[model samples]
Target chain A: GGIITQTPKFLIGQEGQKLTLKCQQNFNHDTMYWYRQDSGKGLRLIYYSITENDLQKGDLSEGYDASREKKSSFSLTVTSAQKNEMAVFLCASSIPFSNERLFFGHGTKLSVL
Target chain B: GDSVTQTEGLVTLTKGLPVMLNCTYQTTYSPFLFWYVQHLNEAPKLLLKSSTDNKRTEHQGFYATLHKSSSSFHLQKSSVQLSDSALYFCALRNMLSGSFNKLTFGAGTRLAVCP
Candidate 1:
């Protein structure tokens, strides 16, 4: 079985700072997604890529940017960190050929001071 | 807009007790429903899913039925275990898209199973 890896298990940033999170998957899946999770809240999709170099925005993509530069990797950037922001960023991949069951990364916990 | 709603924020149960977590949703398209479990400090994992109306789907002793008429996919288990304690999320996938299936999730319910 393949694994999904996310860099920087914990992140701390200052207000207005720009930060980035990276994800890599060995599953060789065709689709990748980025989601944000606030404490006690459900995940909100920020962006997703169906293929390399493709990007699609989700409802919560306004403050974020995503890149699918290669098939195995997808990255997300917080355009400008907001003060007192705290959330977890999760990355997932799936193969749509079967019913899509997403495999997720452990998540990056972000704390913006 | 497609969305999911989970009724309780926290549910505490004893081992071997019956369990149920209410999940309801709203969507304009035929929806594919799913239940995910997240252990502390771990990523959420798929627990159960249902695309066929009124059919029950199960995994790891947990089960749920997707009721299209009521827009509900309530999770249930006859016997709860300590391992079952975790955060549970209900999600929906928009089925109208040809290839891309976008998902929307509900605010999670925290399940605590004690001995």
Candidate 2:
């Protein structure tokens, strides 16, 4: 019955411009994650937080910044949009040590011109 | 380190046929494997997951069994329908690597069921 909401479902930015995506969840989950999805590459983690105001770098964290301003919200910023980058950014959340299932939002599709 | 492999890039099958998508993983720690399905223009959702070896987990008409001996969790469904067309991803949770909520996903397999 809970849902994860991602704002700006689609974004278009010029190369070298900064872009930010927002996510909000009402599941009262303790953990949140940001992943990048490409055509053939599947999904790759960029950042995740287990609690409010905490951030952990993932394998593909470079060139991206994440913030867990509060328990209900997590934000991700693309430091600089790459010309060749056109992918989807997904937001997910879960209750640690409880249910291993993660709830996902529709995702924000990013396109760099 | 943890890794997941899905060898098929695309699978084309007609409706009413049985389907199987290969998934294998590698990890030094205990493996928590998952299968996620993403329909067109929709979010990726958890189809099923399992950490118990040799036990089969089923959901929404799809089934998978975790085999620690071979380190594989293959997704299967009998008599696939047109709605079964989508992208499937196999993921691994490397709990021992300092994070219990992080997942490493494979390249993904796209299934297209035709009439």
Candidate 3:
């Protein structure tokens, strides 16, 4: 069995600060995703990496950046934190298209002060 | 573009009563729908999934019938339990890249089963 671990379960940042959240998975899945979750707004995809060093923009990608420098890790960065970006950010991974099930992390709850 | 819709923001039910959460989706290709349940601060986990049209899939006493005709895969359970209280999300599996599978999730429905 494998687990996806997200760093800094709770993140507090100052407005305009650049904040980063990291995710690591031992599942060795090729596809990794970063999703922002908000109350009544559901989960919106931020970025996804198909393999190492590959990054693809999602529906909500304007204010964020992502890196998949290693196959076992994917990280998301909030370019300039805003109060509106305060939400639960989740990281998920899965095998490419096969079965199409996602394994998600516990999520990082962010707050901008 | 692909999208999933879960109309109810919240559903409150008494224990032992039947429950249902509606899920609908839009996709250009054949749709793959999934139900994910999140309990409080825990991570969301897969509750059920279906790809074949008109077949009902069941798990952990919950079931959903995928109807391609109407683009729906509604989750249902005969009896609700307090343990069933959770936020439920419906997702659509989308093909975005040649090597990856992308999912579009609905806003989610919070089901509160009371005693």
Which candidate leads the pack in DockQ?
3
Candidate 1: which pairs clash?
none
TM-score of model number 2:
0.97
Off by over 4 Å in 2: none
Q: Which ten residues in a row have the lowest lDDT in candidate 3 chain A?
A: A93-102
Q: Order the candidates by lDDT, highest first — what do you get? A: 2, 3, 1
lDDT tens readout by residue for model 3, B1-115: 7888899999999999999999999988777789999999999999998888899899999999999999999999999999999999999885444423778899999999889
DockQ metric for all predictions: 0.70, 0.78, 0.79
Tens digits of per-residue lDDT, candidate 1, B57-111, equal 8888999989999999999999999999999999988677653457889999999
- Residue A107 alpha-carbon offset, candidate 1, angstroms: 0.3
Model 2, range A1-113, lDDT digits (tens) per residue? 89999999999999999999999999999899999999999899999999999999998999999999899999999999999789999999998754378899999999999
TM-score of each: 0.97, 0.97, 0.96
Which of the predicted structures, 1 or 2, would earn the higher lDDT when compared with the native? Answer: 2
Pairs that collide in candidate 2 are none
lDDT of 3: 0.92
> Interface RMSD of the predictions, in order shown?
1.7, 1.3, 1.2
Model 3 residue A72 CA deviation in Å: 0.6
lDDT tens per residue, model 2, B1-115: 7889999999999999999999999998888999999999999999999999999999999999999999999999998999999999999986674657788999999999999
Residue A98 of model 1, lDDT score? 48
What is the clash count for each candidate, in the order shown?
0, 0, 0
